[model samples]
Target: MGGSFGANLRRIRDESGLSLAQLAAKINYSKSYLSKIENDLKPPTADIAKRCDSLFGTAGFLSAMVTAGERPDGDQDEDVADDEVWVMVAGDDGERRFHRLPRREVLTGVGAAAGFALTGGARAVVDEPTLAGLRTMFGQYRLLGTTSSPATVLAPVIAHVDTLRALAAAGHPESVRRQLLLLASRAAEYAGWMSQEAGDERAALWWTHRSVAFAEAGGDEHFASYALIRRAEIAMYRQDPLTTIELATLAQADRAAGARILGLAARCEAQGHALVGDRAAYRRALDRAAALLAEADPAVPVLGSSSVSDEVALADGWSLYDLGRPAEAAAALDRQFPGITASARRARARFGARRVLAHAGNGEIDHACELAPAVLADAAQVDSATVRVDLRELARVLARWPGHPAARELRFALGTALRVRPGSGG
Candidate 1:
C-alpha cells in the first residue's frame, strides 16, 4: 500500500548520488524526512508532492494523494481550517490543500519513538519560515491521521518535512537556514519514526544522527538535548542500559532548557533506573517526571516522548509497568489519550497492543488479550522487530495460564513475533 514511493524516492534521489545530508542541503528538507518519504510510513501534501515531482522529476508522485478516496468526508464541516502553517520559520495560515502522499500499511509505536526524539514541548528559538509553515503542518497532520487510509495517512507529513528540507537547501539566508536547522530537528525525528515504522532501522538511525547534527548546527541546545534522549531510548531497547543511563544524565544536565526538557531527562534517567533494578532511584526519578509533567502546559506540543503532558504520563506509566507496578502502572497509563483529533484509530492493532498491556497490568487478561490485534495488523508496522515491549511480556503472563484458548493464542502469536526480531533468540 505504500506504493514503492519511498523506494522510488530514494532510488531517484540516490541515483543522483546524493547523500541524505547532501540532498537535504540542496532542497531544504531534513535529510531524515526525505529519507522517510522515500521509505513510506509518511505521505506528502500537494505542496510537498509538487516539490518532489519538481525535484526528482517524478510525475504523479503527488497526484495519487489528491485523487485517492481516503480523504475524510466529515471534517469538511470543521471550518477552523484556519490554523497557521509554519514554513521555514515563517508562520502563516494552513491552506485548504489536497495532496497524494503515499502511506504506510499500518501505524504503531514508531510514532511514539519519533515523538520521543522530537522537541519535548520546551520551546526553542526556531527558524522563521519553518515556524510559520509548521503550525499548519502539525494541525493538518493530526487530522490527516484520522482521515486517511494506511496507504496515505502518514506520508504527507513526512513529505512536507522532506520538502522543507529541500527548501532549506535552496540556499536561503543564514536566518532561513538556521530556522530550518531547528525545524530539521523535528523533521529528522519524524523521518526516523516513519522510516522505523516502515521497518527500516538503518534509515532510522541515520535520520536520528542527522537530527542530532541538525540540532547542533542550529546552535539548538534544547533540540540537541532532546535528540540525545531518543538515543537513550534506543539503547534501552537494545538492553545497553549503561549507555541509556549516561545519555539520560547528559540531557539532565541541560536543565536550563525548560521543564519539558528536564522532564524528559528525568524520564530517561528513570528508565535507566528501572533497568538497573534500582527501585528506590527509579521511583525518585519517576516522581520527578510526574511533577515536571504535571506542572507543564499540556497544549504547547512538546515533540516525542515529552510532547503531550500525558506523554510523560504514558511513558511513566509504562516504565512503572515494566518495573512491575501493575496497579500503579495501570493508573498512570490511564491518564493519556487526551484525544487525538478524531480518536477512533486506537482501536487498531498497535494501540490495541498497548491497551492490552495496561489492561493486563490491571489484572484484566481478557481485556489484555483483546489489545493484541486491533493495532498490530502488521508485525512490521512498529519496525520489523517486536517494538511493542509489552507483547514480549505477554508470552510470560499468558504462560502462567497455559490452558486457556485466548492465552494459548497469545502465546503462539508472541513466539512467532519474537523470532522476527533480529537477535531475539528466546
Candidate 2:
C-alpha cells in the first residue's frame, strides 16, 4: 500500500520537475518533512493531501493512508516483542539495543562472565581452545547485551572481564606474548562496558583506557580504536563536543583499524556535532558514515564470536535521532539492528532505547511506551556507566510524556537504576 502511494506521489512530483523542497514550499512544510511523508512516515491527512493534490494536479496520492487507517494501528505492532527479557541493566539516558544471536551465545557469554568474576587479577593464555572458549562467551554476551537492557546483563560482563585477566596469567603459557595482550584488550572492553552500564563514568574511562592499551600492545589497532571510541563516548556524555570530535578524528586516522573504526569515528563526530547543534557538521559526518558503510565486506559471522566489526550505522542512527532526523534515524536503525549477532547484547539494548527515542520524536507515544518493557528489561541487565547513563537519558525522556499507565512503574525502575545502592539487590 505504501509502495503504491509513494509511487504515485513520486511520479507526479518528479514528472512535474519539482524537487521535494519545491513541493514542500507549495504545501508550507519542510522539505524533509514532505520527503518523510512520501516515504510513508507521516501519513498525509485530508488537508495535507488536498494541498498536495492541488499542487500536483493529481488525486489519490493519499488514498493508501485513508484505506489503511480503517484497519488496526500499525505502530502498535512495531513495539519490540521480546517479553520476559531480564531487567538488570542500568542506563544513563535510555537508548537500548537488541542484537541478533545464535543459539550458542548465552552459554558462551555466561561462561565468560563467570570466568571474569573469578579472575580479575591477571591475563590469560590463548590456545585455540582457550580463545575459542572466550570467543564463545563474548559472542553470547554480545547478543544478550544488545537485545536485553544492561541492568540484568552487566554483572556477568564485569565478572567475565575480571576472570579474563586472571586467565591470562596462567603459568606463562606458550606463545603467550600477543595472547596476553589480546586478553587484556578483550578484558578492557568488557570492563569498560560494565563500568559504563553501572553509571560510573570514571570507571568506564579507566576500563576504556586499559582496553586501548591492551589492544595497542597486541597490535590490534582496530580493537584499540574501539577503546578510543568509548573514550569519545564519555566525552559526548560530558557535553564536551569539541573534545569528542577531536578524539573521534584521531581514532579515525588509524587506517589499520577496520570498518568499525571508521563508522565509530564518524558516529562520534556526528554526536558531538549534534550536541553543539551544528547541523552542517552533523550532516557531513552522517553522509561520510553512510559512504563508508559500503566498504563493509561480508564476513562469515557466527554465533558466540566476539570479533569487532562496524557499529557505525547504529551509532550514526543514534546521532541522527539526536539531531532531529528521527525518520531517517528509524530507517538507519531498521537496517543496522538486524544484522548484528546476539553476542553483542549490551550494545543492542542501548540501540533499542534509541529506537524508542525515534518513535518519540516521530510522535508515536504508544509505540514508544510499548517498547518500554523490553528496554526496561535490558536496563536491568546493563550495569555499565556507558549503558546506565543512557538509561538516565531514557528516564528523562519518558518523564516528559506526562501520562501513561506504566509511568509509575517505569519511574521506580529508573530511580532504582540511577542510584547505586550496592547489595540492595540492584
Candidate 3:
C-alpha cells in the first residue's frame, strides 16, 4: 500500500511538471522528506496526502490512497474477547477513568458474576420509573453533546450504557429488558458519534459495532442497517467515496428499516455520490432523502443529528460545493445555515465551515473572511475535528492570495483555530 501511494504521488507530481523541491515547497514538506516518501522509504501521513491532493487538483485520490493504506488491522469487526473487561473508576475530583483490561486481572479472587455487579447488595429492580428517568437523562445528554466538547460528554455516556446493560442483565421482565437494551444501544450509538468528534476513528467504529451488538441482543435488527450508515459516515471522513457508497447502499437495502433510517441512509449515499463528482446521482439521492424525511413520522425516535431541521437541504448545499458549483453551494448554504439553532454549536460549526469554504471557492474571499470568525468561534467552542477539515481547506484556499490582507488575516485566524503554525497547510 505504501509503495502504491508513493508511486502514485511521484507519478502525479511528475505529470504536473513539478520538481521534488517545488512540490515540497508547495506542500510545506522538506525536499528530503518528499524524496523519501517518493522512494517508499517513508510512509505518507493523511495531512501530507490532503496537502498534495489540494495542490494537484486530484480531488481526494491522494487522501484515499493514504486512508486505504492506514486503516488499522482488526478495524473491520466489532468483537470483544471474553477475557477482556471494561473497568471504570470515578475519582473525587469528578474525573472518571476508563480502561479495557484482562478479565483475569480484575477477577482474580472474585467470581465473575460478583465482579460484574454494580454494588455489593441485592440487585435493584429495573422498573418503569427508572427507565423513564434514564430515557429523559439520555435526551439531556444528547442536548449536552451538541454544546459541550465530546471529551466532556463521552465518559458519562459510556457509563450510562454500562449501567443500562447491567440493569438489563438483572433478570428483569422481558419488555423492560428490551427497553433497557435499546436505550443502551442508543447511548452507545451516541458514544460512537462523540468518539468520532473526539477524533478517534478506531474507537468510534468500536462503539458503533458495540451499538449494533446491543441492538441485536434486544431483538432490534433495524439498528444494524443504521450502523452501516454510521460506518459510511466514517468512510466519508476518510475520503473513501467507494466504500462510503457501498456501505450506504447496504444500509438502504433493508426494506423494513424505518423511514428515518432510510432517509438518513439516502442522505449519506448522496454524500458519497457528491464525493465522486456524480451530480445526477447525488441529486437523485438527495431528492429521495428529502421526500422520505418529509413523509417520516415525527413521533418516531430520532436516529441521527437532531439539531438540523432540514438535513437534506443542508446536505444538498454541502454536496453542491463538492460538485464544483461553489456559487450555488454558497447560496444554498446561506439559506439553510440560519435555520440551525445557536445552541447546536457543533452542527453550526460543521456547516458554517463548509459555507465559508463555498464562499472562498466562489472567489468571494472578503465574504468568506467576513463569515469565518463566527464559524471559527463555534468550531473552537465545540472543539470539533470534522469542522477542522473544512477549515484546513479554507486555509489552503486563502493561501492563494497571501498578499490580500483579509485572506492573510483569515489564514492566521484559521491557524489559531486549528492550533497549527500560520501558513503551515493547516
Candidate 4:
C-alpha cells in the first residue's frame, strides 16, 4: 500500500504539472521529504495524505491508501489495574497535574492508612445521596463541555471517572455499587467524546472501551451497544462510510438496547448512507431514527446531544448536503439550526459550518459568507476537530469564488480557524 500510495502521488503530481519543490511548497512538506515519499523511503502520514488529496482533488484516495495498510488500534478489552490510581498535585503557581501511580508506591510515600483512605478503603460506603450529588456534578460538567474546549474539560471529567470507579470498587451495597459504576461508565464515555474533540482518536477508542468495561461491571448490558455507535462515529469522521454503517448496524442488532441507543445508531446509519449518496437508504434510516427517538424513554439519561430539540431533523439537514441537495440542505439547516440551544456552542458551530457549505454549494456565496463569521467564532471558542471538518469543506467551496470580497474574507477566517497556512487550500 505504501508503494502504491507513492506511485499514485507521483502520478497525480506529474499530471498536475508540479515539480517536487512546487508540490512540497503547496503541501507544506519539504522537498526532501516529498522525494523520500515518492521513492518509498518513508510511509506517508495521514496528515500529508489529506493535504495532498486536497491539493490534487483526489477525493480522499490518498488518505484511503494510507489507512488501508495501517494496523488495528489494539485490544479494547484490557482493564486498568485495581492497584493503579491517578494522583493529582497542585503546584505553587496554582497549576494542577495528574499522574498515574501504583497503590504500593502511594502507600509507601503517603503512609499506608492515609493512602488507603484517600483511594477509598474497603470500609468506604457510597450512599444514594453521594450518587445523586455526583450525577448533578456530571450534568454540570456536560453543560460546561458545551461551551469550552475539550482540552479544558477533559481532565476533570477523567478525574471524576477515576473517583467514581474507586468508590465502586470499595465494599458497598450492591445497588449503590452498581449506580457508582454506571456513573463512572457515563463519565468515561464523555471523556471518550472529549478525547475525540481533542483530536486523539486512539485515546477516544481506549476511553470508550473503558466505558464499556465499567458498564459491564455494573451489570449494564446496553452500553457496549452504545460503544459500537461511538466507534461508528469515529469511522464516519474518517470517511469510511461502509465501516460506519456496519458498526451502527451491529449496534442496533442488540434488541435489549434502549430506544435512545437504537435511535442514535439508526441516525449514524443514515449518515453512512448519506455519505455514499444513497438517498433512499438515508431517508429510510433517518425516518426509523426519528420514530425511535420520539418513542424513547425520557426518564433515561440522554445518550447523545441534548441541546438540539430535534436531532434527527438536524441530521436530515446535514445528510441532504451529503446527498448533493445543497439548496434544500441550506433551507433545512436554516429552519432547524435556530432551534438548537444557544449555549450548545459546539453543536451550533458544527451545524453552522455545514449550513455554510450547503449555501456555498448552492452558489449563494454572499449568504454563505454572511453565515461564516458567527460559525467561525463558535468554532474558535469550542476548538472542535469534528466541526473543523465541515469548516474545511466550506473553505474549499468558497475557494471557487476567489475574487469575491466576502468569499475571500471568509476564506481567510476559515484558514485562521483551521490553522492552515495561506494558499494551503485548507
Candidate 5:
C-alpha cells in the first residue's frame, strides 16, 4: 500500500512536470524527505495526502487511494462521498463564521490546464505590475457597475476572484499576499452587490460572507467592517429592517474601521430606524453619519473614485421614503438624479423608480405617472430586480386610483417592463 501510494505521488508529480526538488519546494518539504516518501521508504501523512488532493484537483481521489489501501477494501470509499468543504474564518465578534463550498468548485485542478495553474503553497510570485492590473480592472468594473446592470460584470468579477484566490493560496511575499487577498475581498464584495441587484439573494449573501472572510484574512479590519455594512444594505433591500440594524450595528462597533465605513454603517442603521418608524433614532443616526462624513477623507480607500456624498444622499432618499416623508424623499432624489451618469443605468433605475414611488406615496399620482416612462425604460433596459421591486410597490399604490388614466397607463407600463403577470408573482 505504501509503495502504491509512493508510485501514485511520483506519477502525479511527473504529470505536473515539476522536478522533485521543485515539487518539494512548492509543498514546503525537503527534497530528500519527499524522495524517501516517493520511494516508499517513508509513508505520507494525512496532511500530505490532503495537500496532494488540493494541488491535483482530484477531489480526494489520491488521498482516498493512499489511505484506503491501508484499510480493508470495503472501507475504501467511505470518505469519498464527502463533497463539501467548510472554511472557518474569524467573525467580527471573535466567533468563527463557516463558509461552505463544494469541493469541486474551489478545486480547479479537475482539468489539465487548471491543474498546471496550481503552484502548491510555496513562494509563487505575482509581480507588482500584475497586482496593479488587478486593481485597475477592479476599478473599471466597479465604475461600470455603478451605472450599468451588475449582471453584465458578475461573471468577470467572479473569475477575477478565482485568480486572486489562487494567488493567495499559492503564497507570495507577505505584503503582496495581503494585497492580493484584499483585492479578492473587494472583488467579492462587488460580486455580492451585483448578485443582490440581479435579485439573487442567496448568491448575494454567499458572496458577501466570502467578502467578509477574505477581508478579515487580509488583515483589513476596516474593509471587513465595510463588508458587514454592505451585508446590511442587502438586508435593507430585502426589507429585513431588524437584520439590517443588527449588521449595521455590528459594523459600527468595529472601532478600527475608518470614518467612511463608520458613516456608511450609521447610514444603514438610520435606514433601519426609518423602516421601523423610529424618527428620533433615525435623526440621531443621520446626524452622526453627517459628522462622520465631515471627518472622513475625501477619497474612498479601496476604490478612490466612488462618491461618498452621492451614496449618502441615495441612502437618505431611501430612508426618507421608508419613514413616510415621501415629499422630502422625492425632493432629495431629484437633486441627485441629474448627477448620476448615463452609464449608471442601475443607479438611475433605482433612484428614478423610488422617486416615482415617493410621488405616488404623496398623493401625486399624476406626477408619479409622468415620471414612469423613463423609469420603465431603464427597468426594461437593465432587467434589474431591485428596480422591479420599487416598480412593484409603485404599482400597488397606483392601483388604488383605478379611475385615473395615468395610473392605468403606469400599471400597464410596469407590467410590460417587469413581465409580471396580472395574478402572478411580484
Candidate 6:
C-alpha cells in the first residue's frame, strides 16, 4: 500500500509539473512534510488525499487510495514485494532471515500485545528458544546502529522495543523476565541515542527516560546511570554545556554507578568545561576521567563494547580541538582514529569531521580541503546532526578565504552536503 500510494503520488505530482514545495504550498503544508508522505516514511491522511484528488481532478481517486491503504491487503503489488518492510527474525540454526510483510499487518498484530504489555495483563507464555531469538534480533539491531542511518533503522528499532516490552509482560520465569527488561532498556537507550543523532531532541529525551525506567525496574543501576549520561551527551551536542554538566554530575552522584560510568560522566563534564574555555578545569576533569577509566572493573560491561580509555582519549581529543589547540588536537585524534574501525560509521564520521576542523583551525586550508570530501563521504552515511554541525562550522571558517581555490571547492561541496535537494527531505 505504501509503495502504491507513493508511486501514484509521485507520478501525478511530476506529470502536473509541480515541485514538492509548490504543491505543498497549494495544499497548505510544508514540502518536508509532503516529502515524507511521498517517500512512505509517513502515511497520507484523508485530508491530504482529498487535497491531492482535487488538485489532480482525479474525482476522489486519491482519497480511495488512502482508505484502501488502511486495510491489510490493499494494493500490495507482488512485483514490488521486495520493497515491503522486512525485519530480522532469528532461526534455530543461529541464522537470521528477513521477515517481509505489509506494515499494517505487523502493526495490527503487535498493537494489542503491546497494549497488554503496558497494562500488565495476564502473562502469556513464551518458550526459551523464542526468547533467545528475540535477544538475537536485538543484538542485530544494535549492531546495525553503528553502520546504518537513523532514518533507515529507527522504525525497526521502535518496533523491536515494542515487541520486547510486550514479551516482558508475558508469562515467564523471574530470571527471564529480568533479562527481557534489560534488553528492552538497552533497546530504548539505543533508540534514544539514534534519535539524538537524528536531531529529534524531544524523542531522544522521551526514549532516554523510558530507558532509565526500564533499567531501574530491572535493577540495573549501571544502565540507568548510563542513560543519564546519554542524556548528558545529548545536551552537549545541543551546545548546552550547563545542562550537560548538570546531568553528568547527577549521573556521577548515583552511588550505584561504577568506575566506567564515572569516567563517562567525567568525560561529559570535561567537554562542558572545554566548551566554556576552562582549561584548568578541563585538564583536571580529563585526568580524573582517565584515572577512573584505568581502574574500571573488567566484569562490568559498558554499552557498545566501548573501552573507557578509548572513549576518554576521544573526549580528550575533542576537548583539545574545542580549546583551540589544533595541532595537539590533531595529534591526539590521529593517535586514536586508526584504532576505530571503518564499520563504526558514526564514530569514524564524527572524529573525521573534527579532524577536518582541526586542520582548518591550524591554517592548513589546502589540507583541510583535501580531506573534506572523504570525511563528508563517510559522514553522509550516518544521519548525525553532530557531524553536520561540525561540517557547517568548518564551512563557516572556510568562508573567510572565499577566493582560494581549495576553499571554493570545499564551499561547493558544503552546499551539496547541507542543502535539502528535491525528494530528499528531512
In candidate 1, residue 189 scores what lDDT?
Answer: 75
lDDT of 5: 0.71
Backbone collisions counted per model: 67, 109, 0, 0, 3, 1
TM-score of 6: 0.70
Best by TM-score: 3
Stretches off by above 4 angstroms in model 2 are 1-127, 137-175, 220-224, 296-313, 327-348, 383-423
Per-prediction TM-score, please? 0.56, 0.56, 0.77, 0.75, 0.70, 0.70
User: Taking the tens digit of each residue's C-alpha lDDT, what string does model 4 give over 150-214?
Assistant: 76787678767877776776677888889988989999899889878877676677788889989
How well is each residue in 102-137 modelled by candidate 5, as lDDT tens digits?
756645633212534564533445898888888998
lDDT of 1 by residue, 1-426 (tens): 354656766776777777878866554455776767766867743323434454554443443443355433431111111121211111144212222222221111123223323636222333555468675675566444332332243355555555455455555678777676667667767655554444344445556666777777777767777767776766666545466779888987877767777777788888776554455667688789778766667676666632232555566665654444455655655455433222434223333455566565455777667756644443333323324555675566566556678878877877776655422233
Q: Candidate 6 — worst ten consecutive residues by lDDT sum? A: 74-83
lDDT of 5 at 170: 68
lDDT of each: 0.55, 0.59, 0.81, 0.80, 0.71, 0.72
Question: Highest lDDT: which candidate?
Answer: 3
lDDT of model 4 at residue 206?
73
The sequence of per-residue lDDT tens digits that candidate 6 reaches over residues 1-426 is: 345777789989999999998987665556887899889888876546645765676644565676552433321212324223334444675433344567556655553355555667655566788778877887787678777677767767878776777677666777877777887888888877777777666667667777777777777867767877887787777665566778888878876677888887888888976654556777898898899888888775456335123888888887776654666777788788788887787788888889887777666788888878878877777757778888888887677676789898898888788774212543
Candidate 1 stretches with Cα past 4 Å from truth are 1-131, 138-162, 294-301, 305-309, 331-355, 358-364, 370-387, 412-426
How close to the true structure is residue 303 of candidate 1, measured as C-alpha lDDT? 62
lDDT of 2 by residue, 294-390 (tens): 5655582321124325565666777665544566666787688767555555555667777776665555557766776776565455444555555
Off by over 4 Å in 4: 1-123, 420-426
